[model samples]
Structures are given as structure tokens and as C-alpha cells.
Target: MLWLDVTHRPGQAPWVRLMGRYLLPPCKQRWHTCAAFLPQGGLLVCGDRRGSLLLFPCSSSPGWAVESAGIADGGTSPVSEDTGSGSEPSCLSHKGALPLEAPLSVLFGLHGKMGVTSVTCHEGYIYSTGRDGSFHQLRLQGQQLEVLRKHRPCKGLQWIEELRFTPDGDLLVLGFHADNFVVWSSRTGENLHCIPCGGGHRSWSYCSNASAEAFAFVKCGDVMLYHREAEPCEQRVLLESLHGREIACVRRLGAVEVPGHTTLNIFVTGSEDTTACVLALSERSRAAMPLTRLSDHISSVRALALASPVGVFGLLEAARKLVLVAESFHHQRCVLKVEAFLHTWAGGERHLLCSAATDGSIAFWDITSPITDATDALHRAEGEIQPLGGCSCQRLCSASRGRPRWWLLCSLPPSTTFFHVPDLAELDCWEVAEAGGELRYYCVLCGRGLEMLHGIAPPESPLLGAPQ
Candidate 1:
């Protein structure tokens, strides 16, 4: 139960053979399954075909296998001596492998008859959906599985397809397989409300704001936004038709509070037509307004991310006020450009900006160092995106999942890779997608087309907190 790198090609014998008792499917079980990793890195919860859930933990690191491999000859599996002729029997020599140190240990198992479809891990508990249309919450008490609560103790709803946990609260949104979606309170197990998401789940992609109070889901190129409210009218805040083209991606760029001034939510939508539209959501009126449309790349923009705020610009304005203290401060310079930052986001600890360009190169910027004077500010005003560090990641598109761990995903292999939030280093990565063919070594991943909204830092305003 460790993640080992089998350095062998596909359709080939595994390099390290663990020969002891391993956990396999119980005899003959179905295969339609779903899984989610627990917050703690080692454990993984998986739904099985026999309508059971299993918790599996990694017993060792593949790196450890790599180290022990030397003691085991690593991968020099002895093949039959060919005898240099076609009439020779080949003898197998077992010299390169040892059994896995620890067999797959089943920490918790919920055995049943129906198949489990979806599973998600929350603050402390585990939620799952089964083919029986039932939802269950399980907690690992010691070595046993404890069923804390089960929604629809009798009959369940239509097969639930999608599950989303609100970012800021204890709300779980479940999308049904055939009809509308429901919002449930994971805290109290109450079905808070229901939203009509077109037809069960077809082509709609959903996104929500930080609080999860506001949500937008697109269906067949048309976008609809819904927010939680006491009345019906306020529930449907936006409904826009895209006329024809499908939406490639959409994101909540960033949220900024102007300190006793205004708080705005930024959103960017990239479509298939090689264009992106930036929109703003105002908290005062709970309304979404279109801001600007960006069209520069001839190809479809694939990803988006948000970077740190341009707080350095404030220094230029601040320096302007010190003119009276200088005797010969006579002239000033001004520059403007018509370039467009169509796909943008600020993340990676609010200091790194990422964007996926059409030329197959992903760019990253260091936004942590704010400009102190008008000189640096003028340098950036020339419409050129001067990335702090630039590398070529041949990806079509990508998007930033936004703050905390400013995760950026692209279409290339190692599909999910991230920069260290604080240092922007390419150290940690997650390869979550199902493997299709021979997995090969990959280049560093880069790309994003979404806007990164303001981070969770307190707004330090020279304009608001200054001496009047």
C-alpha cells in the first residue's frame, strides 16, 4: 500500500514484486467506483463495486522501495538463459524483489451489497453515495467503522453524481443523477435548499465564491448564477446566454475589500472562441456586471490564475506627494499601452502570478516585491507581462484553484502540479488522473487563465489609514 514508482514500461512485469497477502477485490465485485484522499496524506477512502467503502493507508514510500531495492538487486529480474537457440526452455530467476513490508491494511471497511458511486472527505467525517441512492457518513473509531449518520435512512434519492463542500462552512452540495441538485447542511443534516441545474448533470460546470453563498454553473454555453437567500427573486442573480460557443472555463478571480469603501468579487470566463470576459460581482447589490473583454490570442485560452495585488502602484502615488520636499523635481513621465491581460490570476501565496499562453509556454511572476518608486512602476506600465521566472510547459490551457495552496492545473502529464505557496518552488505534486498508457517522465507544468481574486490578507490602505 505504498505509492511505488514501477519504472517499467506498460504491459511489462513489475520491477518490485510484493509476493505476500495483498488486498484485492473480494472475489468478484463490480468496478464503477469513486475515491477521495483524506486530509492527512497517507490515507485514502475508496468506494467499491460490492457497495462497500475501504480506507487504505500507505505503509511505505516508494522512495524507501528505491533504497531497499539495492539490497534486492533493484530490477535485475533473471530471465531464462536463451541458450542461443530456438529449442531451449527458459528458466526464471527470482532475484530482484521482496514482498511488500506490510500488506495492504484495511483500516476501515463498510461492507454492503450495492455499489458506491461518490465519496468525499470533509472536516472530520467521510461522506459517500451508493448505487442504492443512499448517502452515509462514516467515522473511523479506533480500528472499526462507525456509521454516524445516514441520509434517507430508508429510500435514497436518484443516484447522486457530484458532491461539493462549501469552502467556508459545513454545507454539502449534491448534484443528483437525473434531476435537480440539493444543498444540504453537513452540520445539522438538513436539506437546506434545492437548485434546478438544467437536466440532472449534462454539460454544466459549477463554481462558487469563497463563502459558497454565491454559485455559478454553466449549461450548454449559457451561464446561471444562484445565491442563497430568503426570497426567490434573489436566488437567481444572473442568467446570460452565450448565443453559441461553449465556455472553456470560468473562475472567481479574487475578492477585495476596499476598507470602508467597497468589496468586489472578480470573475473571468474563457470561452472556446479565443476570448475571455472579466466580470465583477458587487457585494452591495449582489449583482454581477461585465467589466472587460479580452481578445488577443488567436487560439483558445486554456487556463487562468490570480497573482498578488499591484500594491506597488500605490508607492508611485505616495511618492508624488513628496514633491514639495524636493527642490529640482520638475518633470514626470507617463506611459500607456493597449495590451490586454485576458487570462490572469494571482496566487502562490499572493505573490506569484500565472498565465498560460497560446504559444505553449506558461509564465510565472513574482509579485511579492512591491515597487517603491515611479521608476519601477513606469517599467511595468508598458503592457509587457514581465514574469519573474518563465519556463515552457507545453499545455493548451490551465486554471488556478486559488489561495491557501495556489494550485494550478494543466492538460499535460503530471496534470496537477503546484508551486510552493511561500517560495514558489516546484517541489510537491499530485498525479490524480487515471493512468491511460505508459506513464513517462514529464516536464514542469505551467498554465492558468483565471483571475486570482484578493487574498485573505488584511487590506493596508495608504489612502484609508493615512493621517488626514
Candidate 2:
């Protein structure tokens, strides 16, 4: 394990520097499963796949002396690094020196053959769960751990994987028995609910209050939600697992009329499972049917762009890298240092693109010409606008006025900015029609939600100052 020092300066991002690292013993198979830090003592408790708990004292900061250290129980010694001369035992190593230390204590075979899945601390005691269908409450004594109590297997739970406490001070045990996922309450020592989720190898979450409880899990690649309250319990399928996991992004591509059927809205969705799909939505029944899936990407698809007649652009997530693909012309171009692609629109006779960067700057680009085999169609942007650090550009929409005006949503302060399109002159007031064709002047901003007020007039003075 490694530790680092974090430094944060005013008006600057935080910086993390490496402090020190601990070295594990050689010739030992230590497949760690869970770990937690002690609240009172400067110690770290770790559990391994071998059902063993190891405790290491982190009392000393960096720059400690180096020496050969053996396990307190005389079982194994800390691993030794091979210097030019010979091998020497080392427990912890500083940034500039080779200082090593061994674990303070090691308790072997606490859970028999099954591995420890989780370890957590509450109050002054530590609780651990194992795949052996049981959990144990432990306390620290000097450098060793003493078992305070052992809990029996929850009802209908044969293989315990996790243990959590509810807000109402009840212990919650989650595991799998037979072919179902089970949740048991320690306060009543009874099974709270059982869901036929195939097994416990998938992702799951549970939350409960005094009045209601909700459990969500994945089965057969589909997300399922189970809510239990005073009334009859409800269970429903949230999203199908066709993409295998949660979808990342979705955009409406407009509507199409099916033969003999109602009109359907066409949408493109990108998923974390590394695929993009085209789906048809029936507004009448509120159902989405997948039409086709694109499996060309090997990474999670985070963003998508559609250029009709040209092609679809699927963005595979990567740090600070942007690539635009024009499928119809079979051309791929790299955009240097562009952070996020916000919105794209057609302006008179030119195609325009807006993008924001991590450094709080926005840019407008023109890509009107068609892509060719020899050159990319991207042209120099009209200008760049550098804003305050906390400014987050949400959505941009054009006004229907004769003189082009644009509305920009700055979500940080929950306000709107209006300006002329090309020249970007700050405007005091402007009118824009919503998607449903209602004219609205000012946007009533709530926390993460927007309500367009039609009769409300814009402020007499500009909402934002001129960009410098």
C-alpha cells in the first residue's frame, strides 16, 4: 500500500505527492479482499483471500529508519529488496530512503476456507463479513484483534457477502441462498425480503428508512428495482441489459412514422458496456424498442454525434482526447486539446460546433465543408470565451428572432446568458421558442431543473458582464 501527501493552494487545483509505500512479504500469496483504517489508532486493518486479518501500524510518518522486521507471530518476515550487494528485509519505504516495516499482527484462518468480502467499522468495533455465511464483530486489543461476537447466518442467506447498517440503527445482511438474493434484518433476526436474482455475482444496492425500503439489483443483465412500503410491495424492471450495463448517454433524433403503427421517436444511446444502439420509442405506450446496435467501440461510449447523410460519431471515453469520425467519407480527424463537445447546429450556410474545456473556456468551430480523403473538414473557430472557474455550460439554444441570438445556460450559479450569435454581444433581453413552440423570454432556474416563464420579461440590465 502507498500513502501520499495532498496539498491544495488557493485558486489552484489540489496536488498530490507520493509520501511512502509499504512492502509485502515475499513468497506469500496475499490476495487482499478488504481493508479499513482505524479511527482512534493510527493503524490499518486488512483482510485477505485466505481469510486472514493483518494489522499494520501507520503511526510513523515518512523518513523512518530501515531495518529487518519479522512477523510478530514468527510466521513470516517482511519482503526484502535486492540491493546491489544483497537482499535485506524492508517493511516501509520512503520516497528517498528504503525503510521497511512488517505488520504488527496477523490472525490466520479467521473465516476458514472462504474469503473475507467486506470489513467495516462502527463506533469502536470492527465488523467483517465472509463468504462462509457468517459475520464477526471484532475489537482491537493492543496490537491483536479479539472477536467480540459472531453472528449466525441470516435467514435464507447461506453465503453472506456484505453487511450494512440502516439509518434506523438496524444491521442489514445481504447474501445469496439457493437462486435468490436475500436481505435479513438483525434487529428482528428475520428475512426482510427475497428476490430471485439468479445469484450474488452481480451489482446490488439497498437503502431503507423507517417507512420504506428499496433494493435494486442486476439479474440477467437487466436492472431490477424492488420497493417495499406500507402498501403492497412493488417490483419492476428498470432498464434492459441489452447493452449489458447502464447506459451512459442518449439523444433524441426526432420522430418517424411506422407503417400501420403510431409515430415513434428515434433515439441513439451509448452505454458503458461499450456499444451504441438505435432505439424507437412509442410515446403512446412509453416503450423503447432497440432497432440496431453498433459494436465497433471497445471502450465505454460516453458521447455521440449525428451528422445526417454524413454518419454517426460515437465517442469512446478517454482523458482529454477527442476524435471525430465521418463514416460516410471514411475519414477520422483528431481534435487537439478539446475537452467536451457541447452542442452542434447548422447556421445559415455553415455547420457550427461548440465545445468546452476543463480550464473553463468555450470555443466555437465551423465545419461547414464536407470531409475529403486528403483533408479534414474542421475549420478555425470564430472565437473562444474564457469564463470563471465555476461556470458550467449546460445547454445552448437559438432564438427565432430575425437577428440571431443564443441562450446559454450556466448551471453553476443557476442563471442564463443571452448574446448575439456571431459577434457575441451581451444582450439584455431576447425571445426564443421552446421545443413545443411556446415563446419564452427568461428561464426560471431551480436546482438542476429549469422552467421557462413566457410572460416574465428579461431584466432591464444584462445578467452577465461582457466576456474579457
Candidate 3:
């Protein structure tokens, strides 16, 4: 197994070092659903198989604190018996003596709830759906969790998969079973429209905003674009038989300009079939056509994100490039994960392609140089693969920075690991002891490292070498 340090300063070659390994404490209950990052940062919201929600904060202080919103008898623990008098705990004080400010707000699901598969945030509002035939709207106002609105018996929307907000802040929900995709008003929770997506054994489906009136969702080898025209929504199947596999993630690359022609919108999709495809959407047709293919991974591609510049530039120049990170697993174990930085150049040509594989190995390729034929376009050359230390990463997200600064969340059972990219190096690790009760999720609000209370380390802090 190769380990890559997630952090390295710009312009300097990353150094290889093996840090101590840690494990995440086993939760009282197993978590089988997905986790999402908050809009501002420092907070991660996750839902469990049992329809329970947990918030985890990234902190540098002592003692980890988790708040359960809906689990029965499972909310924030009391600060101290004599601590403060209120419906909520004055503070969350752990055995490590770490103190957490009273939760700003907390939302609990209906009792004994199940099938809350995904959660997403936009413009300070949290939207969620579940198997219970419910759609929920929550707002975090100060330290209070208030339900803005709730719609039940959403009719055809059951087993919701993911929730997303369009660039215009309209709510979009992807569900499982019948008429799986629906769009709603963020403020009023009104169902704008619903579309029937196929059911059974699906991977992650991603939705990205195309225009104020249009958005796209990619899944199961197809990309569907929807536009709000009159009263109801209009739908178009932009691309089908894409990569011949289930789409894992999709991101709008921005736009590209063609001299003497209308601009084009580009979108990228990663799939389980080990391929990433970029599609160009024409303004006139509002239809996406295949642009490029990134065949760098040997296994299923788990996640994909375009560089901020590529995404912004796509929106600007109407030309967008993408950086795709993929994880390959065999027999349920991660074999190798690779990251690639690729761009589409002028005249819709595929240009630069840079990749880093799991063995702390990196490769850079220039796809501009023409070969004997257009069919043989890419030129492969090896760069440097510096080994950091870690087995594999569970989640990865890019920073809001202009350049590529990726945050990778690596799970090493019983320990929560954090890594940054450019040169994949470990930035911080928290050793979580196995405890019996269910562990909830939390996120830090401030990004300037974790804050310690009374000299006690915060459990969520990624800073290493602090007091345990």
C-alpha cells in the first residue's frame, strides 16, 4: 500500500514520511449513508442507515463532541447538571474536558425515522428528504434550529437519494423508486416538477446548475438536462450511453466561446466504468454533446471535481477543464486511487492531462502534441510520485481557493483523518477510541484551526501532537 502526504508547499517537491496511524472509534451504531459538507465550512452533516443525522466539526482542540438531531434520546448531551438551565445543553463538555459552545441550532427528524439518504445545503438553508415521504426545510438561525417548512406525502417522491440547490437557489431532490427526481421552491417547499428516473441498485447521481432556468443530473450512463420554461419544467435527455456505465459525479465545467458562433456549456461526469466524459452543451440546442474522455483510472471512479479556474473559466470562456479523482477498489478493498488534472483547449481540443496514482506516484501528460493521427492524440509521460502516508481516502473536496487545494477525508477506522492535496500529505489525524454509544457528526465553523478550552484539546481538531 502506498501512502501520500496530502499537504505540500507550492514549488517544493513533497517529502515522503510515514506518520503514526490512528483509528476512528466504532460508533454505537453503524453509519451506512452519505455525508455532506456545509456551505461555509467546518461543519459536516451525515445521515445514518437508521435515518439519524450527526454533525461533525473539524477542530484542533481536545475531546470530540457530536450532536444527534433525530435519534431517540440521542441529542446533544447535557453540559453539567448544574451547568445551565435550558431546553438545550449550555455546552457540550466531554471527558477530555473540551468545551463546545451551545449548538447554534439543531433539527431532529420525526421519531423512529428511516431512509434519510442524503442532505445538502444552499444559501443557509438545509433541504432533506427521506423514505418517510417527507421533504424538510431547515434553517440555522443563530444557535437555534428551526424548521422553516415541511411537506409530507410528497406523493411520488420516496427514498430520496440526494438534495441540491440550483445556482438560483431552487431546491432539487433526487429520489429512489418512483418518479425519482423532483424540483421544488427553496423558500416555499412547493413541488415545481417531477421526473421519473429508473430505480434499483444505483450509484451516486450528481446535479449541476447549467443556467438559471436549467440544471442537469447525470446517472446510469445518461445525462438529463431540465429547464423551467412556463409553469411546469421541460426535460431533455442530453447524452445517453455515456461511458456505458453508471455516473458517479457530474460538475458543470462552465462555458466556451466559438468564434462567430454561440457559446457552449461544458459538463463532466465520472462513472463506475472507469471513464470520465466531458460533454459540451450548445446554447441554441440546450443539448450536451460528448467533448472528451479521460481514461486514466483502472477501476470505478468515485468522485470528480473541476479545478475552480476550469469551472469558472468554463462559465466565462465557455471552455472548461476538469480535475478528476478516482478510487479503484477490488474485493471491497481500495487498490489504488488516482487524481487527474485535464483541460479542453481551443477548438474543443483536449490539452493538458496530469494524474497522480495511489502509490504516491504522479504523472503528467501533454495531450496537445499531435501523433500520427487524431485518434492517437495523447502523449503519456511520467512525472514524480512522492509517497505520503495513508492507506486510502473516503471523501475528497476541493477548497474554495483559485488554485488546486483539495481536502481529503481519509477514514482509518476509529480515527478521522484529514489530508490536503497538491502533494497529498496528512495535515491532521484524530484518534477516536471505540465507544459504545452512537457517535454523531459535527463541523467547525472557524477555519483557523481548532480552539482548545481550558487547555484541553478539541476532539475534532486535525492538529497533530496536541494533548490527547
Candidate 4:
């Protein structure tokens, strides 16, 4: 698929073009976690079963190979060689070797044979909860790996399925079978709060935009929005009976588009019923609209992310256009994830439609050529436009400034891949064992560009008598 550069004014072609056919070696086991674009350029961290972790660089050079396999059982005693002298029975034993590899080195022998279920990073510290019911904090000091904090058998949380940080840096953990979530102070590891929601065998939870004053969580068929109040806490069901099926993923739309009215917060939910819906929330009531019906996969959806603004803007203007990407499923199946990017254009003349999809392969289509005026076109077209290309994994995310220099994160089955549009070739890929993990790209706190980047220049030196 061709990656078009949409940051520039429409009609300007992409500056870089790379084929989207390169495939990495398959892993011995499935990936359990994936992180993209570390502080270092073009580097990704992936963790998996067998207690292994791998780091892949952006380039194809030999220097890119790095591995951290799991640890082995030390040979502190001999067992099989023992022979019974008389009546005492002799026992036979087998020696277990340690799995030494790079990514595993980062975990520092904290994770056990049950393997890791969730991983997240905050500040410079990496926090992960293992299947062994342990929570660990791993920090990097120069080249040494240190365990800052380790909690064996987290008090109430078991089988951590997801991890998120509140706006205040409070860690929010979702327990798989326990039916509860815990919020902790990151600095002190003090448990601040624990909230319970009904649980399901395969349910997952995620927080909305971190900066929001409140957050929301969805599991099974329920979506609850929580607001922090001084007097008492309040939570209401914004939308329930979602998709008439099990909810797999929830994502908050970045910002809304309203000409003159106050914009409201919106969220999109994907479910196991082969349907996805968009929900708009306001002080008065919640309205949900069905967005798409994905029919190819029989399993529950594992990942969902928003596209870059280039795709967003095109869809906003036309309300209908076609673009597609490659996508894969948790069952190691590949299918196309397609949707229309639609928006009401100038003068409300037409509903502009731009489409995007992932079919395990990349395909590009430019629908900018206007076909008809807005009013007449809406009634005439029966459906939205469809974009090209397919994605293996559903973990989609886009980052951009004012312009359309957005990057798309595609979480494949065994690898986490990245592609920048409108030049839609694979920019980088990291071998990760799991899907539905989270990765973020942001400057370190107190690092360079933290202040200057967000700083606004002082108002021009005003003369003693500046113009009123």
C-alpha cells in the first residue's frame, strides 16, 4: 500500500514510498505485550511467553538483533544420579535450564512460568503484573536493571488484564476474574481506591483520554462513566446493552466537530457481535449510533485505535471516502477493518466520506476527486466510500500536530507494526507476543523540549504606552 502524506494541502503526493511486504521471523510463542517508539528512535519493546522479550530497531542492520529470554532453574543440587543404598528409595529428577535472553533481562526474573499478562510504563519505570499474581516495577539505571518495587500476590487484584494511569499518575489496574479495579498512587504505591464492576470471562477495561476530569470503563455490555466530585463520587451508565453483545474495546474520540455549538465528548465501542457503535455524551443524555458491522471474524475484537488526522480530516470533509489497511485477529486470522471517515463540509453542502480498512495487506485509494454537490449526493449514495489496505492487528493509534503528519500503529499477531500515511509502507515492526497491549510516545518528564515545546513566546515587549 502507498502511504500518502496528507499533512500537506490536498493533492500533494507522498514524499516516501516503501513496499509493505517485508515479514519478520515468526515467534515460538504468541506475544503478550507490545510497545512502540521508545525514547530512542525507531525502537520497540515486545514481551511474550516463555519469559522472553525482544527489542527490534527500525533498520534492517545486524545491530538491531537483541533478545532477553527467560531465566533458568539453577543447578543447586544433583537428583537423577542419586542411587539407593539399601531400603531407602532413590528418586529421579530432571534439570531445568534457564532461558537467558535480552527482553527477559529487563524484567529481572520477576515474572514466573505463568507469564505476564499486562505491561505499562510511567516516568522511567516499567510496571507489569504477572500471571503469578505479582506486580513489579522495573527501572533502568544506566545499563543495570533494578527492581524498585515488587509485590507478590497483589492483595485483591488477580489476573491483571489491563493497566492505565489516571491524569494524576494514579495507576488503574483491571483484574480479569476478580471483577474489580484498583487505583494506586504511583509515587508511594499506596492503594487509593478500588471499584467493582460486574465481570465476564473475557472482558477488558480501558480508560478514556487521560487528561479528562473523569474516566469511563466498559466490560461485557455495560459502559460506565465516572465523575470525581468533592462531596461524593458519581457514575452513570452512559450507554448499555451495547451492540447487543460482549464489548471488547472502548476508545474516546479525540475531539468533536461542531460548527457553532459546544462540542461534546464522544466514544466508540467494538463488540463481539460484529458491530461497532459511536456514543456521544453530554450533560443531558447519551446518544449512541451504530457505525459499522464487521462480518468477517467470528471471534471477539481484540484491538481498536483511531486513525491519524489525515484520514480524519478527509473523512470529516467528504463524510464518505475510501481508504483501507492491513489487519489481523487474535486467532491469528487476517481480515480487513474498514470504516468511512465522514464529515459535513463547508456550507453543509455535502457529506464528505473517506474510507480506511485493514485486510492483512495495505491498499491505497484517493477519493478526493469530487463527484457531485453535497445535497444531491447524500440522498443518491446508499453507502459510505471504502478505503484500501488491510491490518493484521486492530491496535490502531494516530499522533499528529496541526498538520497531517500522523503515524498509525498496527498491532499484528506476533509483531507490532507502524505505518505512516500517505506513504503507507511498513515504517517499523517489533515482535511482540501479545495483542491489545498499550504503547505511548511522549517526552520524558523534565526532559528537554518539555517546557520549551509547550511554552508560548512572551508577548512582544510592550512600549510604556502600548496601543489600547
What is each predicted model's overall lDDT from 0 to 1? Answer: 0.45, 0.56, 0.43, 0.39
Off by over 4 Å in 2: 3-14, 23-29, 59-98, 167-169, 230-468
Across residues 166-248, which tens digit of lDDT does each residue of candidate 1 receive?
A: 55555564555345656555444446656677645454445555445654677778887777544444555255432124456
C-alpha TM-scores of all predictions: 0.31, 0.39, 0.30, 0.30
Candidate 4: misplaced stretches above 4 Å?
1-28, 49-51, 59-110, 113-115, 141-148, 161-177, 186-193, 200-468
User: By TM-score, how accurate is candidate 2?
Assistant: 0.39
Two-way lDDT contest, 1 vs 3, winner: 1
True-vs-predicted CA distance for residue 386, candidate 1, Å: 97
Tens-digit lDDT string for candidate 3 (228-270): 5444347654535555545655555566879988866566666
Error of 2 at 214 (Å): 2.6
For model 4 the local lDDT of residue 178 reads 58
Could you give the candidate ranking by TM-score, starting with the highest?
Answer: 2, 1, 4, 3
The superposed Cα distance between candidate 2 and the true structure at residue 203, in angstroms, equals 2.3
The deviation in Å at residue 166 for candidate 4 is 5.8
Of candidates 4 and 1, the better by lDDT: 1
Least well predicted 10-residue stretch by lDDT in candidate 3: 310-319
Model 1 weakest 10-residue run by lDDT? 322-331
Q: Cα deviation of 402 in candidate 3 (Å)?
A: 65
